[model samples]
Target: MNTEAEVREEMGYSESNSHRLFSVEEYYTSYGKIPKLCKFLGNNIIILWLIVKANKDMHQLVYQKMDCPELLQEAVELLKETSGVGEDVSATIHDSKIKLNEICRVIKEVYEVVAKGICMLGKLCMHERFLSLKV
Candidate 1:
């Protein structure tokens, strides 16, 4: 787990403003309200795309670890139910599962994809593009 300082540094927030950020509990509380959040982002394609990419990256990480199948499954289910598409989401979940079943998968692939996704999100946030979206 990253230390608070490490997390702050990675997010490029100074120590003085770190205290204004959400705590773990607050973060989880926000996560728990994702259905509403999804509704809120209904008109924001860019932010929605970022979320989908992040979810895909997370699925890759979970697949590489093979240690949190339940969590991954739940995430896929949530994505399917909230994405406003039944058949396509099912197909996507199936494809992701098939990839996860590959015999010689490399962990580095997951790391690279996740890192790239995070970098993209960071850039978007840095430019205030994410904040400018209608929600």
Candidate 2:
């Protein structure tokens, strides 16, 4: 079994970085640790909300490239694994379930948005072609 300090070290959490606040991008780039970070923040409302806000800021720059379903699935898996629910029934199953459901809802919304974007892009392309033929 790994100690807490070892886990923190593996996750790129160090005393130096711990003393200073960092933006999401800076934290991610500095650590290069996504799964570990997600597990560390598992189901914490404030942290999750901050993550959502950061994601919204990043979405404008990378919306087309984002794979929401995969990301949500991975998050669920990480939360489950880290929450100790799988290893012991004493873990808070209800909380984990709630968080999982929330992630699924977000996944559904993401798919809906992606589908709408595809439809709009198709319409725009068709309109452009139609206008070109008349000229």
Candidate 3:
């Protein structure tokens, strides 16, 4: 897997260089650990757009919160090992409030099939995680 610095060096750009202008595709394809993880997690355009629009510091904070790089690799490996079966599934998740830990557990345990179904049914193109908010 390419780290942010490697990708930046390959593309001849980095967050440190603000003078150069680049397309959204080029920008997201080249920088940041979170952007790299987002690409691996399905590469949804809206999510990428959100990431590009979000504050850079917030993304750094998320990386700190999630213990990134490590979490990123684990997520990619987990997704790879449990390739989606594309089964048909439907349900209403009713709750007064959903905790982040519970959401994380569901994501780790059960959302795989549901996400596959959503993609298979064309209801959603893909699943995306934007961790710009404080975790």
Which model scores highest in lDDT? Answer: 2
Our model 2 lands, by Cα RMSD against the true structure, at 13.8
Residue-level lDDT of model 1, residues 1-135, one tens digit each, is 445576456555567544444354423213444454334434434455667779878865321222256446645544544443344335546655645434223333443445555544444454454346534
Over 41-95, each residue of candidate 3 has an lDDT whose tens digit, in order, gives: 4545546357456845465422123345645665565565355321111111345
Q: Which stretches of model 3 miss by more than 4 angstroms? A: 1-25, 28-32, 35-97, 108-110, 122-135
Ranking by TM-score: 2, 3, 1
Per-candidate RMSD, Å: 19.2, 13.8, 18.1
TM-scores of the models, in the given order?
Answer: 0.22, 0.29, 0.23
Error of 1 at 101 (Å): 18
Q: How many clashes in each candidate? A: 0, 0, 0
Error of 2 at 132 (Å): 0.7
Flag regions of model 1 displaced more than 4 Å.
1-3, 22-84, 94-135
Clashing pairs for model 3 are none
lDDT of 3 at 18: 22
